[model samples]
Target: MSLMPDRKTIMLVLKDVTQENQYKREKLEQERKFIEQTRMAQMGEMISMIAHQWRQPLSSISATSMNMMIKIQLGEYNLETKEGRDECENSFVGQLEKIEIYTQNLTTTINDFRNFYKPNKLPVLTSLKSVVEKSLKIIEGSLHNDNINIIYDYNFNEKIELYDSELMQVVLNIFKNAQDNFKEKGIEKPLIKITTKERSLIICDNGGGIPEEIMKNIFDPYFSTKDEKNGTGLGLYMSKTIVEDHHKGSLHVDNQEAVEGEGIGACFTIKLNLSSQSMEG
Candidate 1:
């Protein structure tokens, strides 16, 4: 008869395995919390952008209403005279049209944020150009406020199967980081350049380059160069996870340099494989 394992040996091995599993569970829980924190921060930033986007339209509507009231008070909007009535009617119609346009813009902003933050049920083939455009819309207000110029060069025409919302989040995060850097450093003529290639995209900022000493640590969790009030340090880490870990793609960064050996800020590159078959919802 073959000898069987002793009770003490079996119990010791089982105990070790149990402890290892418990340790893994704890680590996973911590990571889950970190991801949630970053996501909440992103939502808050998006809301700020929405507020900015709505401000101009709301002001315009208010001004138009005030003007109409002023005209009425001055007895310039008489309904009895055909000329006065026509002028009043035209002014009213113009104001109404302006209000309609503003209302549509507000509605679109809400929908874009909602869709961008909604959890994805599954990965699908998505156009990169569409994703970039949506991400820009989400943060356009913030960029304008910071007086940063954006240049987009879409050189590729293809779709990749992936989580669209996740990708957009990554793109938005990068842009927000660039904007903050420009503000903090007070860079002159701040610019963000986004260029697409056959299967990759590059985002470069003119807010000076990442220091060589800290470049390698940029992707590490909870590692941020910004002051505590402005940064949680999880944005870039989570962005790396979404691009490289979750999507089976690649995300890397480097200091863009000129041929004369001058630093030209940092460039983050993302690459994804083109999907042969598109997935349906």
Candidate 2:
């Protein structure tokens, strides 16, 4: 009998990934839509804040201009005598200085808001404290309008690499949430305490804690505690995505009981690696 050469059969299995690819594409599109929607909602809130911020400065400018006009009409300055001319010049300079200061403030406010809305093309090296301060500045007028007290307890100022404006958005979202909660609960003494430690930021509000049942779902997309009119349900979800997914950080929340005479409420903590290596990764 002739020995037959051993033959081996190889089988190949192939999968058509068309459906999977299509699903992924659709998911990305949905996320883009969510981002755009969230941005529109934030734009509305920002416009309101901008109006609040500009109101006083604009009023001051108008008042200053009117005062100067009145002074000119009344012929208050004696321009003939040397001393009178110097005094008149000084008064005009003083009024001009005030107007300049107010104008500068208005310009700064515009720049702040513009930089905030401008998209970041690259990560920036910045201290967490600075980012928090910037975010606070943007929303300061709104906070003042609502009579909300913001307390700062910064224990960290290390520089880290990240998208500052995006982080600002996250900060603003948390502030807005606290503000809304304060209004809804009618907290008499609304307070938000911001504390930074190591590589973490903690924001605590005394606007009553998140309900136990809803706490688990706070980070879920389209989940909201506020009614349809007030809540887009994307703030916390986008915030979580920005910190964790985009920056490789962590965001967590919990209810804190009253302690040391402090009011009880919700607390949000964000942690990011401080090392440059981590950011690069």
Candidate 3:
């Protein structure tokens, strides 16, 4: 017969186990709520971006339609003449093609957003280039509408073990922050440069840098430099958590400037491991 622990000892051990399980449950619940809230916030931003992107294309389509109608009403577009009819038909077809292109772009944007919001059950080997490109596609509309120029540098063709969508979320958050800063400060010639190294990426924007006073607390929950009307303050905090706590990576920020006082900008740097392993840890 095997000897077991005394009754009192067994009770104590069981109590500890129960407490630990309860703590884990509570932590899991909190994480679930946080993820949900963050997703909702991102969806709201996506809607705004879609509106900005759709507006120009929709306006072009409307103007094209009106022009065609006017031409027809004025008898300038004559179906009887091959040349005149061909000209009008070509113009209409061209506008329809443009509309189709824009519509396809919008559909792709929605798909990206939907894929990103899904839960990642396990880490997969994904290329950094693809991840960055996908993140850019989601926000390209907003960037274009704001007239901000994006410069991509560096190349990472190798794969990394990560939840790609989570990493994409971090990239999107940093990019949107830079964009917001540029618009808020009215920066002329706004530019965002993204460069990647073997296992890291640096995103910098020429929108002026974060103030030293608030830099330390930038990643703290509920700490926001933007006014309440513009920010919920969880973005950077969540990004940090995703990088450090979830992916076992590093996320840092610095003020980058070529000279003492010129081209001062905020730079966010992220580093990840290149190995494949269990993300559950």
List RMSD in Å for every model shown.
4.5, 3.4, 5.2
Pull out the clashing pairs in model 1.
Answer: none
Candidate 2 residue runs with Cα over 4 Å from true position? 1-11, 258-263, 277-281
TM-score of each: 0.87, 0.89, 0.84
Instruction: Name every residue pair that clashes in candidate 3.
Output: none
How far out, in Å, is residue 173 in model 1? 1.2
By TM-score, the candidates rank as 2, 1, 3
RMSD of 2: 3.4
lDDT of 2: 0.88
Leading candidate by TM-score: 2
Candidate 1 lDDT (Cα, 0 to 1): 0.83
Q: How would the candidate models be sorted by lDDT, starting from the highest?
A: 2, 1, 3
Candidate 2 per-residue lDDT, tens place, 120-215, comes to 888898888889999988999999999988889987756788899999999999999999988988888788899988889899888778888999
What's model 1's lDDT at 270? 94
Residue lDDT tens for model 3, 170-222: 99999999999988899888888888777787898888898899989999877
Report the C-alpha lDDT of model 1 over 54-166, residue by residue, as the tens digit.
88888888888898788889887778999988999998899889889988988998899989878887887777777899898888987888888888888877777778898
